[model samples]
Target: MWEKTMPINEVRELRGKTNIFLGVGAIEKIFDIAKEIKEKGIDKVAIVTGKSSYVKCGAWHYIEKALKENHIEFVLYNKVTPNPLSTQVDGATKMARELGAKAVIGIGGGSPIDTAKSVAIMTLYPEYTTADLYEYNFIPTKSLPVIAINTTHGTGTEADRFAVVSVLEDGKEYKPAIAYDFSYPMYSIDDPKLMVSLPKSQTAYTSIDAINHVVEACTTAVTTPYAVMLAKETVRLMAKYLPNALENGEDLEARYYLTYASTIAGICFDNGMLHLTHALEHPLSAIKPDLAHGLGLAMLLPAVVRNIYSARPEVLADVLSPIVPELKGTKEEAEKAANGVREWLEKVGVKETLTDLGFKEEHIEKLVELVFTTPSLDLLLGCSPIPPTKELVEKVYRESL
Candidate 1:
């Protein structure tokens, strides 16, 4: 086997002292983390969160009450969206600064945590607009400490430096809002019960999002031995546990495995990152902000896999074969795994097509233009093994229609 060279080493490995708040019922952990922040003499703290599964599952109130009981002067910014905007983040940073919050707590799912990261960065540099932060490496030298609690098992945005804010630059919106800060959470709370109250539809969407993270990261770039190992583990756990976690929502063990798999996928992609599926999905989510990201992901992913099918088919096919059994071992078998993904997504009750979600062909041109013209498009789309052009992007959009 020829040695695989690292495509990019620009991803910084962020290390920070983290006070991990956790448990199946870790209300105590919340209290402990809050008290620690207070005793450390942190001046002010702000909590940025929103109504989501985490709110329904009840971590939001628990954390909120804990902070209030501790008498920590803080502000609350909860007007965040599923696909959060740069404007909202700027608003949050202003809230934090006006309140004089020194530390920030992120509750709910990826959106709020993602919101918190942007707010954390913006607090230190109040002079800059959110647009100034969208450039690849324009972040300030330091930021306020942020703690996150992941109440969902997907899109592990809480544990890393990458926060992709979809903001319009010159009349176009793209993702990857900030990458330089390595906005590593000052703490992470992974509570399995947090996964329990999720409705089945949401459970499926979030789980597949995690699964795709593993598949895309494993196949996106040249895999290092370590990255591949975590990717494989993520795949194994997801394959074995996703359906069970969905079917048996009350099982803490299944919840734990799925949550760990989601985080493993996060760590996997944190090292390897994502490709066209995510890049394309960003616009779909932005255009239809009502769509859960995982739902948009499910809608666009199979098309992305099929689009990339013929390019580097052997390696991607093999990496994916086990998840869809028919693709394992044989060349034809390996090559067919991409289609199997689409089939499995439908079989598992993920939305089968764009029409299922009420989107029509009329939406294609706008989505395609967004995909091409969005800020940071050149960077994210460039990650595909077979480079995609504006035309190819339209083809994927039309096919999904």
Candidate 2:
């Protein structure tokens, strides 16, 4: 038996419009959520999930039981894959509309939850395509209720108002993120017990993704003191607990703090917004389609940090000190700080270059072009502390290679 290392034994209902329930046994809240929705006259809901995690993480059993025991009807759409495509959302939306699903339950990590968010919105607008929504062709005013059951410790889609989907246009794929007030889940659950079965690569990559969230959030042009404080704590928790979780997947204490880190990182970005790293990573995954979002972010992190370090050297140094202990808050130490971060990522087994991932030197210009042209990516670039010029974007990609 693992000894508890933190005060995570009791489930706490976090205060927000989202109604976030967090702790070890928080999965049980699905029963109460089912009853509440039933009382609202919502007899049916649509469940959007990936192929295996919903069942592997042991969340589906409880969710199914809750819906059945409460006499709430639901249809399961489990075809959502990683780097979710707009077409998948359309399919799920079609099924939900046919069933008259009044709410959507997203069970898994970011992909399914994000897909669920898109389905919730598109179900309301039967005539619009996801491309229309993501490209700002139509401004989304509202969505059906969303209940998120997160099975991964990264991509806090459960807490944020953002949803990312890749829309294929012509022959190319454009992955753009959309954030709307109504996209926030009406209810969300983060239970550490549900995350104990995550694979090792996912364990490392997802936490790194969480770390990247804070790094960009704290260093962005609109960064606030509140975001910076949360960024520091997020980095500290990931640096300390991630290794323990990787070593023992069943370490609930490690899972608890990592889950907390991911949650706050999501809140941090929702408030401070993001900068070059996420802006740049989107195009990478959009181009490859098979690349994991977090892995792409990890590959570009060092290069992006090297470019933006001079913009807020003191804050960057302080926020990254947990992983890069020798970093000093000075513009002259930019290369040293970036190298230290790269080394830390390697120590945690995320050693991969753009070349290793099949990107060539010839691909640099295309990535640079996509950063400026992709929907919402230019907006993210505007948040960077440094001027996101074409040459600077090109240089970041070259350095990563």
Candidate 3:
């Protein structure tokens, strides 16, 4: 383990019959949820999803299939999009109200889970929009119990209180959402067996997204030693195992560690928040949609770190340097630490320049404008030692190209 400060992780500390149920494999993982549902004594179940991945991949269908087998009554609401629209969540909440769905199950990756968390909030509160909680909304109303079955483990949606959704508000894209301590899933299933068949591209994307989680958390200005320690372990696991999982889909150990790493990063960031890479990536995702969160981080981090190093170089380098031994020497040699991260990314196999990704040279100015104006920029911009100036951001993009 890389030594650092211990974590001051936030606590909700629910008591009683193990509020969370965890399963690593076995088809029974989905089957056992009905008992939990029965124990929660819920009426109808509203499943919020629609990416075609769950039904086809056996994750989404497992609950329904098991529900029928066990003679449990339920409903399915599958109208979710990639980023998830607030209107769609409202529609799902309406359906749940009509059906009287007493509980919710989120099956699939981050999007469906976000849909489920947001729907729970809307159904319970009935007053707030899915757009309201983008920045720690901390909605007070308690939500219907959620059982999140993560067929994939990139986002740590099960472990988090945040539900992220994007919508076009007033003809312009306004990414909005909320989070609260009460919003976390009552149960988060982490089963690596279900991950056996995950495709290479998705494995890469999700695992890289996990890497972004750890790296961004550790770099923040207000990070605690507790945050740094957990983030350090997470990055070490992601750096070693994410690539293995991406390269060899059936690598159970790799998948397990990466998945665990993903969850750990969410816990780490919840206490300390995140830094500029996430701040930069959000605008790109809103505008491009083509670039998902992880790939966007992959493209921007090398440049982001290189720039930040000139300012807060030592702390940042120490945080990451343990994982990348290539740069380890004396503190005086820490100047080369940023290079280690770039080399490690290449070794993990991030290819293509930003230009190769179809990021238009013409769009850089527009993206810069979006970055400056967005609320997320405010959330994350100050985390950087040298807060990004318009000219500096543009220069980073140019260097990236």
Local distance difference test scores for all models: 0.72, 0.91, 0.68
lDDT of 2 by residue, 1-401 (tens): 23254479789887665778899999999999999999999999999999988998899999999999989888999999889998899889989999999999999999999999999999999889888888889998999999999988889789999999998777766889999999999999999999999989999999999999999999998999999999999999999999999999999989998998999899889999998998888989999988998899999999988988988899989999989997779999889888999998998889999999999999998898888888988879999898989998999999998
Q: How many residue pairs clash in all the candidates, one count each?
A: 4, 0, 6
How well is each residue in 28-132 modelled by candidate 3, as lDDT tens digits?
A: 556766765776676478888775766765665567777776666777787776667677888888888787788788877788888898777678766566555
Cα lDDT of model 1 by residue, 203-267, tens digit: 88888888777667766655455556777777677767777877788877677767767876777
Give me the overall lDDT of model 1: 0.72
Better model by TM-score: candidate 2 vs candidate 3: 2
lDDT of candidate 1 at residue 44, scale 0 to 100: 83
Q: What TM-score would candidate 1 get against the native?
A: 0.87
List the candidates' TM-scores in order: 0.87, 0.98, 0.84
Considering every candidate listed, which one attains the maximal TM-score? 2
| Candidate 1: regions farther than 4 A off | 1-23, 52-55, 68-70, 135-138, 168-172, 310-318, 329-335
Q: What TM-score does prediction 3 earn?
A: 0.84
Q: At residue 105, what lDDT does model 3 achieve?
A: 80
Q: Which candidate is the best by lDDT?
A: 2
